[model samples]
Target: MTLSAAGLGSTTQPLSTVYDLAMLDLDGVVYVGRDAVPGAVKALTEARTNGMRLSYVTNNAARTPHEVAEHLRELAMPEVDDGDVVTSAQAVAHLVADAVPTGSPVLLVGGDGLRGPLEERGLRCVTSLADEPVAVVQGFHPDVGWRQLSEASFAIQAGLPWFASNTDLTIPTARGIAPGNGSLVQTIRNATGASPVVAGKPQKALFDETMERVGGRHPLVVGDRLDTDIDGAINAGTDSLAVLTGVSTLQEIIERAPGQRPTFVSADLAGLNESHLEVELDGDRARCGAATAVVRETVVSLETGEPAGTEALRAVVGLAWSVRDRSDASLTVDGTLGA
Candidate 1:
């Protein structure tokens, strides 16, 4: 399962030459809150300048595509169009619109950002408990209260379908942290003993939508969380790179499942420029700089069930080893490896 540079049709150019597109995670990969990560803008500009197509994918159910683009522009990362952004709210809206009857009344327990998508689909948004809702759609709302949860709980008990933009329990914010949609969804779930359909990262629907929006090419999914970004990449059959600037920690990356492991890992965007790997005809090899051993061991553990002990564990270590080895191998593109 090793992806060689030649197999990717890059023997003369650099490994970056083989990747046609990059799917970037907004919150942690590019910027945190309002401040851009160090060298994030430079890395993005360089990638774009080098001719790589870029798309920003997020699980934030609070922002619309337009709002996301505005945030990116404000952060001075890279100018991205609405078409290049995807949000859980948009995905959930599509799900609701397709499944539920058109113009059905929906009990929205979120903000205007999340409600906008459903409204755009012609769904009636209702806040009153007296209104009969066909479904309960939950998203991020700072003003969430017990009253809203009780209303949603009653709706679910009355046989209304429950849907959540994302089940993320915690959301990153400028004011430390706050409960995510997952927490709110959990309250309702616990109260009504109901389950919610999640429409965010790690869900195949959002990934499919993203791929379709990006024209379905071999793209690299970059993010900070292993559960969401890396898992989404696995579900989408794409490569992923994990950065340490967000929710995922070094220990977590080391313990990720093989299918959920990232193809590349870096401290931040700053080190990504120097990050290089060779995708040979046989397999991929990564160059060791700082976290090479950790990446290698993690990949090995993922590929094979063997522990990260000194002994090389066996099992389906082929793809995992190849991925680990090529993390810094010299890839050949069109008979020439890029400098």
Candidate 2:
């Protein structure tokens, strides 16, 4: 929604009281491949030290929770327990085990890590559908082949459930980029024209699991991707912080509708802790930083494609105050209106 002065003062609020739990996206938010983002570790540690509960949620299907934890340790991040990490591999396994019969045979087209969760769920993993499998489970398979896709389609066509771990088409890899599970899932779907049940971000199940793991009065989701992380937060009925370290850019944020807009946005995790202090509103954007009072002004048309007016000016200022309240920032308005 377009920012108006009337709504500004009412919306701003201090951020400290706005969120209790922070749901962090691992890949883009914490690091890109093996290199950790600057200040990621410090930001997260500070959040925890400030009494905020933290949990790392990832869409990486290639790594298991234990493996992910070790990777984080190598990056010098705070220690995370096994239960604190969630992955698409784990999500798919949970879905399959809960829905399908125990000990059911399923054709797995993914890596050893993806298969680990399935095995733990008591599902027997097979290489092909030759055994008349009960289902076809797909995740990120770096060595996937056309033969595997054909076999998965065949299994699904035979009345077997087609389950996909996630729909992330492109996964960031050390070697630039690699095809993710979505690419394979689409290939199988194109062959059989079959739609499998997806179990990952942008889905309610993943969000539910995350909230359950990091319980809080209010949880804030932080991520760089719009489709998965942002959508997930919206689905979970929680606020979100869209960082520019990953998929979405500043232009995309400017063009987004209010429903898709994050509660806060920043260059990286570095400025997140300052979100509760002060209120900032410039045109369509709004942000908060820790401070006692904030005031902002911008010139804009009273009507769409029309000239500016005193009414339009007052509207935006009021809107900034409203935003301050939402961010839990304290506010005070003065009569000195700038032209």
lDDT of 2 by residue, 205-268 (tens): 6767676655677777889888888888888777777676777654454344446656665667
**For candidate 1, lDDT tens digit of each residue in 223-320?**
88888888887887787767777777655654444455676655665433433433222333322211112223333322221232111111112233
Residue 284 C-alpha lDDT in model 2: 39
CA shift of 86, model 2, Å: 0.7
Cα lDDT, all candidates: 0.66, 0.67
- Among these predictions, the greatest lDDT belongs to 2
Q: What is the TM-score of candidate 1?
A: 0.78
- Residue 301 shift from truth in candidate 2, angstroms: 16
Lowest summed lDDT across 10 adjacent residues in model 2 is found at: 299-308
In the order shown, what is each candidate's alpha-carbon RMSD?
Answer: 8.4, 8.6
